[model samples]
Structures are given as structure tokens and as C-alpha cells.
Target: MAFPPQVRGNKVDPDLLAQLVPGTSSRADVIALIGSPTAKATFDDNTWLYIGEVTRPVIAATNTVLDQQVVVLTFDGSGVLRTVERKNQDDSVPVAVVSRATPAPGNDASFLQQLIGNVGKFSPTQTDTSRSRQGGATNPGNF
Candidate 1:
């Protein structure tokens, strides 16, 4: 049997997210009320956060719904919830990604040069174990 990654066909519940409030609900309350978040940050032990996202394309082959969520909680010096920031997928400006590869400064050889280099690296003498009677060394060279 073969199994590949597949996406689910349902959207997340925004109604549940709309009910979240700071300073009133704790971590345990959040879990009991809402589900676990995708990711979280540990700025301190007193606070927590949750996030969600979705991505879609036009082409069926490229069409995809990518969901991402982040949770962040910050605490004070006395171990109290200072702040909680939950980042989710929202309508925002797109960021560009640039990639460039620089060739390493070195000698690039041709096919003949590569073949000659490999041939030159070949050992002049090699040992054959099949001809050894007492399990010692045996000469493989014909000459």
C-alpha cells in the first residue's frame, strides 16, 4: 500500500476564534474551549497565543489551501501574563523571495580532462584475494 499527503476539505471555525478574550481565559480554558493552535511561542510561562491561515490558487494543479497559525505568550518578572499575540493568515502585502547561485572559483574541465583525471587516479598495482592460499596477499598485475 502507498500513501501520499492529502489536504482536508473543510474550513476552520472563525466563530470560536471570535470568542477569545485576553486576561479572562487561561491556557487550560483556551484548550477546553477551543482546539490547540498550530504553533506557539514561549516568551514567558504566564501567557499564550494561537493563530490560523489559509492559502488558495487558481489552477487545480497549483490550487492549494495552506493554513498556518502561531501562538505567542509573554510574562512579567513576577510570572504573570503580560501580553498574548496570536498571528494568523490575514490579507496583507506579499513578500518577495530572491535566490541567486554564484559559481565557485575553480578549474572546470572538459570530458577528456575528466576521463584522463580519473584514469590518472587509478592505482598501478592492485591485490587479488581470490589467488591467496594462506589468506595473505596476492599480486593482481599480470606483469
Candidate 2:
């Protein structure tokens, strides 16, 4: 069976984008035309970003990116649009992920140890006394 690609983030329309004029459009005008941005610049408040992507499900529930669009808008000190930049999938840079796992402080058990670890930990005859003290019925028939 085929599944539709998942669309994420806001994709700007070219017609509406054309209406945004540098030095003329304010932050409010941009918001009215294309809605709010997906995110603002981490360090600079004047820069806003509208990012979008389409991903398809691949093997083992992993997703592969099919398309990506990023629109970067910069505003001047007066809040007037200074520049508008658009980027596509081709402009993206591939990032390599590290496969090394971080070592956690714990005992690493084997497959057999993990499978039978709790074998004798629970006793079938053991009943929680706390439940009986709290006006709750203890099911002696249940193990």
C-alpha cells in the first residue's frame, strides 16, 4: 500500500509573497499576508523564517525528506521588510549523525539475564498488605 507524503510547517505562496515589498511591508503586513513565521532567528529578532518540508515514510518507520522550502525574511530597525530570501531542497546541507552511543552508568545484562531477571523477584503467594489497610479488598485468588 502507498501512503501520502506528510507535509510539515508552513509553505508560503508565491503570489502572496510577491505582495511583500522590501522597505514598504511591515511585520504586521507580512503576518497578514502570509501568517506568522514558523520561527524567528535564534539570536536576532529582526530575522524571521518560514520553513516547510514534505516527508515520505521509508523502511522501519523512518521518514525520508521529499521536498523542503525555507523563506527567510529580514526586517529593518523600523520593522519594515528589508529582504526576502527563499531556499529549496537543493540548498540544504547534509549533516552527518554520530552513531556512537553514550555510556550510561549501569550493568549491561545479557539476553538470558534480561529474559529471566525477574523470575524469582515476584512471589505468587505474596499479597500487598497496604491495599487491605486502605479499605480495599485483597484478591487472594489472584496471583
* Number of the predicted model whose TM-score against the real structure is largest: 2
Candidate 1: misplaced stretches above 4 Å?
Answer: 1-12, 41-51, 64-91, 102-116, 124-143
- Where does candidate 2 clash, by residue pair? none
Q: In model 1, which residue pairs have backbone atoms overlapping below 3 Å? A: 49-71, 51-69
TM-score of candidate 1 to 2 decimals: 0.48
Badly placed stretches (over 4 Å) of model 2 are 104-143
For 54-102, candidate 1 gives per-residue lDDT tens digits of 5555444564546655556554545434455555556345798768777
Candidates' TM-scores? 0.48, 0.71
